[model samples]
Target: MLSRKASCDSHGQDSSYFLGWQEYEKNPYHTVHNPTGIIQMGLAENQLSFDLIESWLRRNPDIVGLKRDGESAFRELALFQDYHGLPVFKNELVDFMAKIRGNRIIFASNKLVLTAGATPANETLMFCLAEPGEAFLLPTPYYPGFDRDLKWRTGVEIVPIHCSSSNGFRITSSALERAYQQAQKLNLNVKGVLVTNPSNPLGITMNRAELNHLIDFAIDKNIHIVSDEIYSGTVFDSPKFVSIMELAMERELYNADIWNRIHIVYSLSKDLGVPGFRVGMIYSNNETVVDTATKMSSFGLVSSQTQFLLASILSDKKFTEKYMKETQRRLKKRREMLVSGLRNAGIQCLISNAGLFCWVDMRHLLTSDTFEAEKELWKRIVCEVGLNISAGSSCHCSEPGWFRICFANMSQETLQVAMQRMKAFTDSSNSAVSQQQFVNNTRARSLTKWVFQLSSYESEPHR
Candidate 1:
């Protein structure tokens, strides 16, 4: 028998919810032969914009260097991508980031490090920032994949800063303090705090105030702050995104140390709806982190061809600007449709303004208020209802009876079918509950009448 490392052995049983969802995708119920197909609302994907991207690509055949003038450019892009990334790619990325952040902040090419995707970017940061046993604070009800991205290989631990739903699951100072104290109690070295702005499960963007609190907390603790802003371009409403870079720039006027500790991870997967391209970047004001992560990029560098293709496309200011606007508009419309459909089914989701998914409240659907009960409900939703939405337990949500429903991954007709199934389930559940209540009421009334008759007979004189 081959002996594996202790880390691998200990974590081998820990399965990823995403990998499990893939199994469902392989032979999904919704195929041609299967009438009741599985409707997957679990994956955070943006399939809604594929047609637009494909059409644009078709219109611009020059993007592939197929044009006579672009032949040399295509050949150059087909070569090996540097660990530090192509300068042109880096330059275009900086401009794109500045544009999306409302141009309030600007990034230099030296500050950016390229990786395969945000997953590797996060793993690289974990390796660079923290030691094997150190912990990073994460706001609870976070993205489930963080476990695999940040901790699985790096040996880092995640200490959740439990955020409550009462205030829309917003991260608070008190929660930060509690998480810090809890880490201390466990005798773990707290190295940093990782936050996903335009959060994954919640789909809510953090306001300036919350960002300030996080900055202050990190400064006070003298720990690092890793801001995952992959969904920055997905914002559709108010409380617009405020990048950590912007905050650091403003603060550097008074305190320069803050800049040294801040790092950001970004990707085009969510924004461009090109997860297949696997382009991810890390931008940091900290020189040491920038250099180290750049060197670490050797393990998972973005393909040269992909970098070249994106660089050419992103450099087109007119196209990028228009694309961003249209993407947001479509996202907002889809979000509204999903919210309305769920509402019609009496399934209330947490109010969200960004990202591809929503935190749906399903506590009423659970058999009991426990993670085990949540798992059962998840099974019923997947197997019976044929809709594969993620369970709250899988996302490290402290509370049960919540799920993340991705709205941009399916067609309008498929989404409608999912809503119908959910509504049917809810209606059936309600009917069953009502019938049980009626049975209990009838039993209670019969018992009351029997007791009264017995008392009356006794009162008539010991009959």
Candidate 2:
């Protein structure tokens, strides 16, 4: 028998992406041995920038202290990093974040706390803000990892604010209020609201008005606001990325108190295409939160060697700027390709401006309107179609029949194949439906004819 907490730790097994990846690892599409291997479009990863990143790294060999600064500096970097993060790394990160957000936001190094990744950064914040069993309100169709990141170890709860597709899934004040009220009804203590601007799955960036509404709601309720901006640099189209830091500054000009409650989580994974590097940051104006999280970061601090290399790369103003522009250009190209391919297949995707994936509607293809039907369709797509895209249910979406399809995870060739597979699946499904309808119609007509003949015979004849 497991403890109650142990029993609750089911996110890993529950996550579709995890299961999909497991299958993919067993037989990847790129391998010759597995010709009909799975095409993994479920994980939000940016493999498009690998060539660019590799080129940049080659140009800056001194990042490893091979040329400049000698062996001593290299040795120093190889040692344990400060729990609060190396000063040089923090300074470079501050600049990198500002540059990506169009310099509209300024980050202070002292306020930054580094963790292994955004997952740990979020967990750190949850620990600092809420006690065990307390809740944070998240918008529905959120990043599925939040359940594990925020709640797994810390015992924090998530209350979802249901945003409907009718309104482009934008978070509204009414939705926030409804979630808060629902939390209250459940006797849960609501601590804060968590938002992913340039949301995961949906890939939509929240406009300024929506962000302002969030600020107002938090102020009215005196609750904390955590904005996860990990995908800040991944924005391709306009209504550009807005940082909570930028909003917090504007609010501070009038009311300084809100700064203490506003926190931002950022990472290098999506933007820099460096998930393996494990760089994540927590920037907060609250000194106490910063101090607490800094202390908590020791258990999962980034490698000193990784920090040193990234610091040097990020500090290179010219390379960093060029890299940002090129990354966005490639991401935009990939996004258009994926969206166009999906649309051509008669599949509709949510309007998304940023992020690595898009929210796709597959409801019409479902056997029914229920989540169980959604699961069945998801299974068919994975097992039959060999395309692994995440089901919206995994992301805590209120509605069924949606899935998040990652566009940047594969080569163009692989993506084309995946799209083709999706089209084939849809075509076959439609054909099956048409065949079933034809069979039903034929049966109905035969039954009607027999009934009419029987009525006519009984009326004329021998009674």
Candidate 3:
């Protein structure tokens, strides 16, 4: 009835990640109205720092009004803008990026390409980097959204570089070799490797050794390394973030072939708690790539007014610095609360230092050590326990029984309610049933009656 990608489930929004979101939306939990309904823990959104943004906007009404010192500039902001983006915003954007990375390296504004958001930025990169049927490797337990962002429209393929839980799901040289070999076996052309630093599902940053290994792999394979560093600013704890560029500089890969091959996908969505702004960027050493991306960016330009407002916000060094510290402080507090809540429920999560979510281990809760059992447990948690979380399987995790539970998007009271629900579910599931009995019991429920589907939010892959 339409294009093959459109006609198929390849877009990947129909799976556990999104289905849970559907269930949550249908009967969302509210303290006053629907306390028994599902608490949405599936989305990886940052809402903790909106107050700072509001405060800043309130103080700068002229910026908010697209005016300079009370003089209206609405006509200029409302008119068409170049795909190259506002020079002021791009300049400040890089400065913000540099400040986030502890100012280890400075980014060239001309080398940056602007897009509507990280999703489109990634897609645009895939369009420039690889052809249909070409593949890029990804680490397991990745953000579920990459399936749509990197592959859906581009016809690019994702070959998972499986990381083991034994090493905290850290990337290893052996995994890269295995993944590349696997791609070769499938007769696929390898384009590059895509990674999320302060990773999405795992919420941990890649160390220096791993970054060096990635550079080695890129050089050896003659491929690129697309580091999705949208969560760079979300790193709240120590052993602080080490950007791939920082390492590249230390190793002096600048202006080299390896340098040009490294591209970064960054966004204001997670860092600013403003997904509505739709401002994302790609910073590469390859000028041709930046130019090509800029041309392609016309298809998804950042609105000029949004750029004007952000330019005003970011240029205030004091405000941005304070905002950064405050954001980290709140994120750390929320992270501790979620972890504490889980611990109270007799659950443990991967020790994470960044991002809006926790990679929770409910492996002990499953009746069997298989993905089917994982899905079974996931369904029960989402449908019965009244919480929606992304299953590890959707993140292409090698093992079962892990889930991403987001804490930044909800209120403290709601989070407490979710903690209580999780505790109740954990307590009830203590007297575990055999796999057969578990399957039979789940079969007895009216699945369709409760999980009526209506869906988006680019759901976490399968969100």
Candidate 4:
């Protein structure tokens, strides 16, 4: 194992990027003081809170669907007579989760367990499922949090499957098999596979048949499946989102006639648009897995208030139906707008069939240093052009040149203007090779200025 010092020297202070929580907590007020923090993708929720919710309610009064509010389902629990019996409200919440999720084949029985949100749940799963020497496989241009959370917490080996440009950032079973073969050659522990459906950053989804192949591979290898289904309900294209758990259930029922270990994790943060709620759930059929996760986290339970709110919202079928429809409509439109704009700008992106983001590949134009170059582009757009979007470098384990542009939060007009600014920037960058050369030439200018100042001081001979 590399010493922390050696790792620090190799990776440099870039490791500081992973120290997000404690560092942010220390000075979050700074961003508040700055006020110009427009369209930050770092935080999970809209800052407007009650006003936004109320406005959403007013604009579409009939859109009572609360598909994203995990706590909203529990609102009706208040009317229940007792907490125990044939129909305890909490039990209903559990059963409802099992039913809706189970019907989808996300019932990993013992393999699945719910957590506060994807982060802790993911970190816990990585720790539990992966041995110190084992390899955990994730797609390239992956979720940034998964890489950070895994390494920071468990120190396990991470294997990334880089999807090619021809494939549109989509991972195939062949890709997994190749990764598996590579892992075997390296003699890696080859513990588990982590995948996100309707993926983050890329915004693409896998079909049922595709998912089944992956599940079968995991089962055959006797390895665990870590499925991040946070965006499961946010499908934009046809075929919908098919889950590995559902595939596992199907395989157990027909193919293998035996249970396979697959773990599915979801969070209310994305779908509910109430990221602050910080509620997450995991599901699996592996008893040992669930038992271990519960023991690790059983010291505390989800907040009673949030749970009640989720219960209220979820049980309201009429509300959820309407909400989901409108949400999907808006998401689909926004995705189209962004993809179209990116295409017009000559920037290539993975076609987002589902989810709230678009994965933009900018390697053809620029390379990211600590992904800072991509962020600088966003800052330029935000500052010079009054536009805000996510940079892709934050999504993957490898140093990525991609940017994730989110369409869920911005107004249409703002999005259009942002796209125009981005187009202009790309065009200007292409035409302005001299600009970079000039900046490089100016590196010694400051030193020259300092030398002149020292000469002036020597002549003066100050006391």
Best by lDDT: 3
lDDT of 3: 0.91
RMSD (Å) per prediction = 1.9, 2.0, 11.7, 10.6
Tell me how far candidate 3 lies from the true structure as C-alpha RMSD in angstroms: 11.7
Q: What's the lDDT for all of these models?
A: 0.86, 0.87, 0.91, 0.62
- The TM-score values for the models, in the order shown, are 0.95, 0.95, 0.92, 0.72
Error of 4 at 183 (Å): 3.1
Worst lDDT run of 10 residues, candidate 1, spans 7-16
TM-score of 1: 0.95
Candidate 1 segments exceeding 4 Å error: 1-3, 6-16, 19-23, 29-31, 66-68, 253-255
Q: Given candidate 4, what's the lDDT at residue 162? A: 65
Tens digit of lDDT per residue, candidate 3, span 112-184? 9999999999999999999999999999988888888888899999999999999999999999999999999
List model 4 lDDT by residue over 147-203, tens digit each: 566766477777887666566766778888888888888899788888888687677
Decide which is better by lDDT, 1 or 2: 2
Ranking by lDDT: 3, 2, 1, 4
List where candidate 4 sits over 4 angstroms from the true fold: 1-38, 41-112, 253-260, 367-393, 397-400, 433-463
